[model samples]
Target chain A: MSRTRVQHFSISLDGFGTGEGLSRQAPFGHAGERLHAWMFATRFGKTMFGQQGGTSGVDDAILSTFAVGIGAEIMGSNKFGYPGWHENKDWTGWWGANPPFHTPVFVMTQHKRAPLELEGGTVFHFTDAPPADVLAMAREAAGGRDVRIGGGVRILRAFLKERLIDHMHLVQVPILLGRGVRLWDGLEGLEQVFDIETTASSSGVTHLMFARKGG
Target chain B: MSRTRVQHFSISLDGFGTGEGLSRQAPFGHAGERLHAWMFATRFGKTMFGQQGGTSGVDDAILSTFAVGIGAEIMGSNKFGYPGWHENKDWTGWWGANPPFHTPVFVMTQHKRAPLELEGGTVFHFTDAPPADVLAMAREAAGGRDVRIGGGVRILRAFLKERLIDHMHLVQVPILLGRGVRLWDGLEGLEQVFDIETTASSSGVTHLMFARKGG
Candidate 1:
């Protein structure tokens, strides 16, 4: 009964998961922190970053479930670091020494690197294998628990195209990012496979949850 | 203080306003009545089509605003009829004898045609003009009342690009039309000009309302 899930993924009104021109200095490019402002304002988000004083409403309620019942994570290389992260061997990640994901983290990339064991019980494993192969590895590492598919849009779309996602939660921010990596491009008619539900938060973001039917 | 507004314009979760392959046989193309099913379930929608016994909740409350406020309407030729409608001289419109729009409905198209006045005070005027010029005509016909910018996606986006819309209400339906005319194309950073708000109905549709900041 181990399921693959995606939680708290934010997208712009135009369906862009992240803005264009991502770099080391600007991890989200022109998007900055706009796409994640809602999460940052949540109590769960504040606590995750070792901060204090944040709202504990519906936004927080959803953000709190991000790490629940999920062992291990499969993230795209872009989510691991900026573009061309392979060139820099010293690039630990956007998160400092103490990372959030305490489980085994699998970073999907074409370039291979030795496994990195960071502080706070987080271990980074680099691989160039396809989605199904990577999922299989992550599922085994999950130890009979659900596997979380951490995304940077491309990898999420790939797993979704293969119908590997059991439960997906997408937070639709109201801002219109005219150009960027769109999340809904090729995944047309997705409602046919998933029973989608939407909840609008007071902070001007819509939470869309898609659960695979008969999964 | 008359303004131009769009209300109860339904689109898929993927931002598609209308599906592909629109013809006389299928008005909404592959989408059929799926996109507007939420509206049709509303009491206001049932009354519009001369039916009865429908829900009168938030969906009805929103759908009722489609015909509220002042005067004339501006719609794309595609909204008026199928493609190549100019070739058919007898093609009055998809709406039978008495169309829903009782005001002067201006149809924007490159091929000009004579004004076709139908029953119930619905006069169809064809003109090939820019957004401002067409707005001028519609405004004049509106007679100091607010003008409603009816859309088929393209015209709505054109008016939005020109920053002429004072208020816009878009209903995000749960269905996903894989292929269709998108409503949010080329409309980057639209949140800068408008104050946006969202409300999710129990019927699984989200209503997004945008009002011009200063207007």
Candidate 2:
């Protein structure tokens, strides 16, 4: 059984997973854009945008870990698009022309959309299938590499609830929305254990890596 | 024009700005619960639960800032008690006999719910009127002291969208829900200029005070 890893997910100072001051147009809100400013300012970020001459720092190192060279990525509907979870097959990935998930990306959605082909092998497979199934396909697509669970929050919950997550790398940034959406609710006590593997960063953003104590 | 402070909000890495996870229930989502934990772990927190002998730290200090010798506080209808945007008037404060806001706390709502006097000076008012109207009520209630806008999201959005918030304080904690609801979504062109005032902590949590550059 292959394991799933959640990497580089950042949060506002207020504990929101995402979507604090969000709308259909902005989606991530003002603060959320700030949460990831550090990510896109690095060498790895430049590579994603087809730019050159970027610096390598804590941000670069972290973003580089999420590259196609490292793992396969998975996401939920919310991360893929907007609200109105009703059937809308026309919804495309947020990134215009070329999305960052150039590798095979698995999206979790009840409404199925055709596999979207873009620059690189970024074939977005939308499935109404269960998280386990999506993850399984993602693992296969990853080809023995680690699978990164990209999120909008719901997808992360599904895996966490089932204890399917192996390593979680959280990049907590400094900024609070106070209210919007949150990362921790309901799933409190269920024998979920994670051991801190590392807490490293150069920017104000702190990266925390936690894995099963023994696994 | 009296300035309104939108305190303690959350956000995610992608800027989705919402926490509403389907399986996730009540008051945002996973991140919503994280936002509450800081207050819940404070001495003022114990005071709210009719207990005592709680520890003090940045979290406690922030809580004390609101609990002891405070000015006034405000909460949206969702945080006050009522779930989502229901026109019903049965809901009151989330706290049972006593709520954390010991001073006068204003409630933002559309439907009118008869103000029920709690054990403390905490008062819940229904202002379906407008954001500015509620702000006026809150300022008047504060007399000459500062007013804290305790929020869920929408209420914060009203002020944030209107650019009415002055000082914004966010407590960044480490935890992930993966998905429930979000905080900083849909807020575009917020044009907020902030000054990082103070920083300190307890319980691995950091307390950051951002005074809107002008205010």
How close is chain B to the truth by TM-score, in each candidate?
0.98, 0.76
lDDT of 1 at B130: 92
Q: Using DockQ, give the best candidate's number.
A: 1
Q: Give each prediction's DockQ, rounded to 2 decimals.
A: 0.85, 0.06
- Tens-digit lDDT string for candidate 1 (A1-215): 89999999999998999999999998888999999999999899999888999998999988998778989999999999998888999998889998999899999999889999999889999999999999999999999899999999999999999999999999999999898899998887899999888999999999999999987
Candidate 1: which stretches are off by over 4 Å? none
In lDDT terms, how accurate is model 1? 0.92
DockQ, model 2, C-alpha based: 0.06
lDDT of each: 0.92, 0.65
lDDT of 1 at A37: 96
TM-score of each: 0.98, 0.55
